[model samples]
Target: MAKFIINGGKKLSGEIKVSGSKNALFPIFAASLLTEQPCRISNVPEIVDKQVMVHLLADLGVQMNVSPHEVLITAANINKTDLNPELTSKLRGSVVLLGALLARMKRVTMSFPGGDSIGKRPIDSHLQAFEALGAITQANGVIEISAEKLVGNKIILEESSVTATENAILAGAMAEGQTVIKLAAMEPHVQQLCEFLNKMGAKITGIGTTTINITGVPKLHGAEIDLIPDSNEAASFITLAAATKSTVTVTGINPEYLDDFLLKLKNMAVNFEVGKDFIEVNAPTVDYQAIKIQGGLYPKLASDDIPAMAILATQAVGKSTMNEWMYENRLGYATELMKMGASVEAVDSHNVIFTGPTPLKGDKMTSSDIRMGITLVIAALVAQGQSEIEGVEHIDRGYENLEERLSKLGAEIRRA
Candidate 1:
């Protein structure tokens, strides 16, 4: 087991280059299985979640090589259609392979996926999309699916679920006709996936909207794609700078994708400058007004960001509220924050209220998930005295070389 022994009250300052999107690359990696040629992806993050994902792909007979910043994947010799049960249980992203497998070999079997238990993430949309595309689905302890001939049609997703929508798009890419997806997820990562598929010869329009159109292609050729910087990680650093009232610049980020979070930062009179590809945040140690935020679908705050937002709320002068509608279990992180002397109330599963300007005193804490794990580290950074944060592995599953990166910005952190 690894731990982060953090001496808090350090003001972080300097530039940190963000990594590629874990959310974007995982699905893209799964989508590569749809093609026989090699698909190369650059700007890949070196994190544990991706390692788990890569292992799952390797088990399914996909050939790949990983460098620091790129991965070349070729699926020419795929020897399996069913996913490894143990491997799939380790990654939620494994569920995405349902569409790619059904598209390539027309059969797939897998048990339920396990990821961060932050919410009730159902794959009904994925199964429904496959069934709409002419696949048959049978659900038992393990789910089994097979399709004779996929006939593309209109798919209307009940919720703006990102992975389910990507599954639909991957399966629809090879269907016999046009497939129109309504009420689709329009998150930037989803658009990036669409762009990647388009580069590989799939016709997809409606880049950032609720309605998306896809025309099936006989075959897709391999293409090299560079994933955009991880906006979620970017949000984490931005909140860290603000929570500690430091001046830090995050580079290689898409300011356009950060609108949902930046608006809230601006409302609190937090200081920041946005460039085309970067955002620099500087938080003064003085008091700021409390604010209310709601996390939701694309063009809005993402649920993964709620933990960081809660940390930001803790630095304000008065009471602040964060309403999370995406996940029922997300607010559980507040218990750990309270151990560091934060004044937080978990109002049921979907809401949390933070009474601000609490002088956090660092202490021992456990990590529940990836996002919340990083949030705890951020809180420890600003908390007075020392704190031992276990579950550093959870933080490692997302952020790459987190201690090294923060050390460059003057954080007193060491990995144990």
Candidate 2:
């Protein structure tokens, strides 16, 4: 029930270090179950979703040592094969354990996963991939999967689902013979997982391509890995700088991962300079023109970043069209922007047209999802009066010390 009180009309100016990738850490944490030895993961973000994953691991009898930015996981004495429904229902990433559990114990049972209500994010792809890897899946309110010696085969994903691709890789890495995955998601996180698996004795090739081949290994040993920085979070902060006419430097960013997003920001006339490990974005005095964005699997505007762009468009000069073909309910949070005087109309479940340079006046609003919650906070920082954002737990599930970081950049915001 925590809320954020933000006083508006302040230009944010400072440098803030970015946190580890939330998306990367979840699958990596699940991957720890693939080995009985201790797997040490660094750059772990201290966020709510991470805590949920840690709790789920504990429920499965894995010993875990958690710090602010590091985690040590030992799965030697894992005595349980099933995840608790009550705990697994807390976050969408909980579904990631299915592949790991099935690989280790040949069975997994869990209820449907839950998190941000962005839309109908079905796990059919995950189930489909599991079935493709010689596992039997039963679905009702809860899903039950079991296998007797997973044998690898060719898997062409119905969609380029990131989680499903990760699950298949995890499951395939331990299966007998070779497994080939086609039309897989080629996101940076997916590539990171493939690299980590290769380091752990699993033979994986084509790390950054749509087609991945995994050769099963009899056993995988523990290895140390540092996760890539959270590119989505960095993009959100860059959009904030552009919206509020601020200058902010984000450290710990990977330039290669941000190439596509930076180009899009450049198209909007936002000034930026990229370093080897950092990127700085400086906002303009006058509002910029609207930009069109389309979402795809990779090398496209991430669907998670659409809400942030929607908020940034409110400060732009003309109409902006955002086509979020990924999720349906993602645009629902735009109503909160309307409360702040933004002229955003949901053309359909998958599209929104925003007309702006609208004078935003702060109001009380609730966060609907992780990215949208952060977007609302960005809007609150640039809006006219004081604004209160409820459901801050959603924001905590992703960003680390968001208010503190923004405050360092001269924003007037505090957690209450």
Candidate 3:
């Protein structure tokens, strides 16, 4: 197993470019299967989850020409419908392939998908959405979905789940009639997928809104697109700079996509400036104010960012409470933070309280999930001594070349 050894108290100063969206790339990759023509996508990140998706698509006879920054995928000769369980089980994004494959091949069977173990993330919404789209679903140990001919219908999602919304959009794009999705996810990545689909002959509209309309077409063709920079990554970098009182700039990101997080930073008295396509954060106040973080749908604080905010809270002046009702185990990292001398109380599975200006002392810890892994790295970078973090593979699943990138920013971090 790989570990990240860090010598804390280094003030990171430099510009770091944000990577391509991990959430957006999965649906786009799965959508490529909708066409036989070659689809080229640029600005692809070399994350572990992406490699897992590439392997999964390859197992289905899809050919890919992968480079450092892009992938040219040709799914013209796909020969299988049952997903390889080994690959599928390692990536939660593999679940999006169900709607894509069912639309292209009329059937799909695979075991449950997996990724971060932050909480009980069920696929009930996805299965329910597929059923609404004229597909027959069988759920036991293995999940099977098939449709003789997918006919469009009105789908009101049980929850605004991002992956569930992507699946519905993928299937709805090629479903026989007009499909309307209500209470859909309005995430930037979700909107990016809809835009890519439209370029490939899918008549989709009302993007970046809760209600989406898809006019199904008989077939789709190949298209090329560049992915948006990852807003979550931008938020993480800003959190790191603020926690360590560093001056850092994150470029290649759309500031509009990160309004919620940026607003939170402003509320906490973190000095930051947003430009056309970049964010430069200066050192925060010596005694910053603590504020509550309430997680909700888009236009609100994302649950994925809660851990980073929690790290910031440790350096704030008062008690900061985080309410993340979306995921039961979102606060699962509190114990790990406590080990590093943070004053944290896991109020429940969904809520946590952090009290601060606490001086963090480094300690050995284990990562539990992707966001938690990076959150610990930020904590370690801001701590008083050396810290060692195990299970960095979880970190690699999201951020690409994290240690190297942070090293460029002058962090004393190395892989061992």
lDDT of each model, Cα atoms only?
0.89, 0.88, 0.91
| Preferred candidate (TM-score higher): 2 or 3 | 3
lDDT of 1 by residue, 306-415 (tens): 78878878888888998988888877779999988889887888888999878899899988789888899998998999999888888888899999999999999998
lDDT (10s digit) by residue, model 3, range 246-348: 9999999999987788888888899889999998989865568899888789978788888888889999889999898787876767898999999998788
Best by lDDT: 3
| Candidate 3 TM-score to native | 0.99
Q: Give the TM-score of candidate 2.
A: 0.98
Number of colliding residue pairs in model 1:
0
Q: Cα RMSD for candidate 2?
A: 1.1
Q: What is the TM-score of each predicted model, taking all chains together?
A: 0.98, 0.98, 0.99
Q: For model 3, where is the 10-residue window of minimal lDDT?
A: 324-333
